[model samples]
Target: MTILVVILALLVGLVGGVLGGQSRGRASRAVLDDSLQREAQAQAERVRSEAEAQGRELRAEALRVREEASRLYQEAEVRQGQAAQQREQAMADAARERADAERERADALRERGETVRERETLKQDRQDTKRERDELKREIERLNRRAEQLDARGEKLDAVEEKLEAHEKRLSEEGTALQERVRSAELKLYEVAALTPEQAKEQILSKLDSELEDEKAIRVRAMQERASADAKRHARHVIAQAIQRSASETSAALSVSVVPIPSDAMKGRIIGREGRNIRAFESLTGVDLIIDDTPEAVILSSFNPVRREVAKHVLEALVQDGRIHPSRIEEMVHKAQDDMKGFIHTQGEEAASSSGVLGVKPGLVQLLGRMYFRSSYGQNVLKHSVQVAHLTGIMAAELGLDVSLARRAGLMHDVGKSIDREIEGTHVDIGVSLGKRFGEPLEVIDAIAHHHDPENGETLYSVLVAAADAISAARPGARREELESYIKRLENLEHIAVSFPGVQSAYAVQAGREVRVLVQPDKVSDAQATLLAREIASRVEQDMEYPGQVQVTVVRESRAVEIAK
Candidate 1:
């Protein structure tokens, strides 16, 4: 029994030790679990703090973006308002320009209408004057017939007077035979009565001288009346009307072209290194490049207007492109020449249309267009030609002739002048050749050749062209004359007037359009002074070549001057 109790105590002790070790292990595990929970809570607090900081930063950035967007919107609104204002201003400017253009158009139309009215009135006046002239011519014829009848009656009266005188002579002879006896007896009685026969003969001669003075007074009165009537019936008014009917503008054109540069610096560029560029330009264009002290300007001079014009275009293009060299100059010059040709064609078409001419050949049109660059005595050839065409048409209409043919002839009349410098011939001859070369009608060619030679103008169309040319060239300020030529013409006029008899002094006045002469009163009577004026005018017309007409006025005054003594 003692051994069994010892073994059971040992087992109990061993089991108790096992239970103590289990309790200690369970307490350590619980402490470890609490430490772990605390660590996890701390980590969660750190994560939340970081997340709040990120949210604040995001809000701040969003506010900045919103402000920037607002500022940009404000700027865009301002820009839009400015754009709208500019557009309104532009629209206003356009409207004003359109209104101005319309006003100009209206004014032009009004002027055209007024011109038409004036032309019609002139035509009517011319017709009326022509009728009056015809009537006056009839009156002159009647006067001439009456004068011839009076001459016949005077001859009959002279014959009757001669017969009466013969009868009186026979009677006187018979009376003398009878009176001889009476005279012998009377003489004897007179001697006795102390009377003389010479006193009776002297008394009879005094009575005859008084009768001759009375007959001279009657003839002077009749001649004066006839001269006054003839002066009133003259045709000077018709020529004045024609001159007034066609009036045109006068403008001067020069054969020089001015090219504008951007600045003074460009002058050097054009001159180039050692002036090679300018030399090239001049050689290519056949024009002189005159670069003087004038600022930003160059002068191109050439006798040939076409060359000057082409040079002007080339210079302008080179200046604009800013590339000036030999190769570039050659290129530009060629281009300009081509452009000039095209421009000439267009100008010809415009002229043809404006002048109311149609069916002109293309080659002829080109030639006509070239006339735009040509000038005559400061007058543009093209413009003068156009004016001539219109005037010819008007005169042709009045004469009941072919208006179109007249206009065509007139327009082509001076075409030869355009190329006369190029070819070796007179303008008239060149024009005739050109017309014939172009297959123009014979009448047209004849008109061209005889425009200056009115006597050779066979067709009425040719005559009209001649008249139109004169009207155009002789209009006031239509052409320019050299100072030398003008002085020479005036001198010629005075010289012609002085060559006439009874002219004490001659003066050319009114720009050589008229001449006045002072005549000796004793040498030229009142009736003779009238004849002197007509004679002087005739001499002037025959001896002088002048534009328009010249007036010859002869002055004669019987002073009877006694100084009021």
Candidate 2:
């Protein structure tokens, strides 16, 4: 509300100021108009006065005009005189100007005439220049035509010369060849083989055949060679296929079980615990009863697989008889031990008879029977030996090796394993020493020593033994229970062998018994491959601990061929 009042007051003040200014201007304008009117009146009055004064002057001028007319007449007379003099002078000057103009026109006409002549001369020069240009054009055209004709002739000559040169070169080559043939004919004629034309021809044919000198004949020979190679290849393929088809012996799992009993009561108690019962049982059977199960059941463990089996039966018998006592246990145990021995002997005889392993001593047979108690890498050594023997026989027969030697080597390879726990050195060394001392063949001894050392190259039989052992051990799931450290050692054996330069790939085959390394052909030379194989084998020996030995094989191959069409 206060602002509104202030605005109203300002508007009122502005309106009043505008009205006062407009009124003052109007009053000033009215006063100015009155003053202008007075000034205009004064101007009019002054103008009237001036007009009167001008009228008076006009009257005076009229009088003066009369006088002036007289004076002008006189002056006109004098001016006429002076004008006459000036006209005369002007006429003279005009005459001179006309003369000068005429002179300039004459000079200009003279110069134009000279210029016209010069222009004609220049036109003549232009015509000459045009004629010279035409003549030069004709000359150039003629010269160009002549040059073309010369070029054509030169080209023809050059072609002829090139033909002659080519012909001469061909003749020279033919002549040289003819001269060489002549020299050769002269030389051949001077040779010891004096010959007529027919004889020479025949001798040449004979020489071609003898020396394999003719390319066509060589081609025929190559064909024959290829055919022969193909036949050999086919034979090899057939043999390989047949071998694949043939039945092969596989590694056998050999495990032993030792059963324990509860008490001596069970033992003869196996015999029925009485003198009468003991006598009856001893008379009935031959078996040993161990009444002591110190901490456990009756010890029913033995090396002889058969004896152990029989002992099992005898114990079963005594248990069935239900006799109980220390004496009876003794009786039953004795009978059981005896019966078990007989069973073992029979089994040995049977094994020998079946496998054609004759001349085996009974004591040795018993010792062999004890193998039932022994195990190597979860395998019963005796059974493994038997499997190895069979595999060796089959392989030897197929490969045309010594079948009997291979089988014997395989069977005895692990013989030292039986006492290895009790003896020092590797089983191979021990078995070799044992075989040598026992008067076995040198071959057998060597085979035993190098069975695990194929690179030893001591004997072929050793290689066969090693191969058989591998075949037995490499079958699926065979030796699966090997110690983790042993398996890792075998893996490391192959890893070390393959770690060498140039090997592209490596496989630990034959239950880690062999490392087959494939080397880059471009990188590995044949000599280098051989050295690498030897080095890998050495590295396996020095860096790895493994059962048996590892065979390192490095293979490198290169091929070259040319294709013609």
> Best TM-score goes to which candidate?
1
Query: Which residues of candidate 1, in runs, are more than 4 Å off?
Result: 1-239, 482-565
Per-residue lDDT of 442 in model 1: 74
* TM-score for each candidate, following the candidate numbering: 0.47, 0.35
Query: Number of clashing pairs, model 2?
Result: 34
Quote the lDDT for 219 in model 1: 75
- Alpha-carbon lDDT of model 1: 0.83
lDDT string for model 1 (1-565, tens) is: 3334454465456545644655678666665545544554454455456556666777788899999999999999999999999999999999999999999999999999999999999999999999999999999999999999999999999999999999999999999899889979978966885657676556657777787778777777868866764564343333334565665677687868889998989999999999999999999999999999999899999889999999999999999999999999999999999999999999999989988999999999999999998888888899889988888887777667788887888789888887899989998999998998998877778788888887877777777778777778766578776556778888998887788788899999977878889998888888988898888887876777765578888888777656665
Worst 10 residues of 2 by lDDT: 241-250
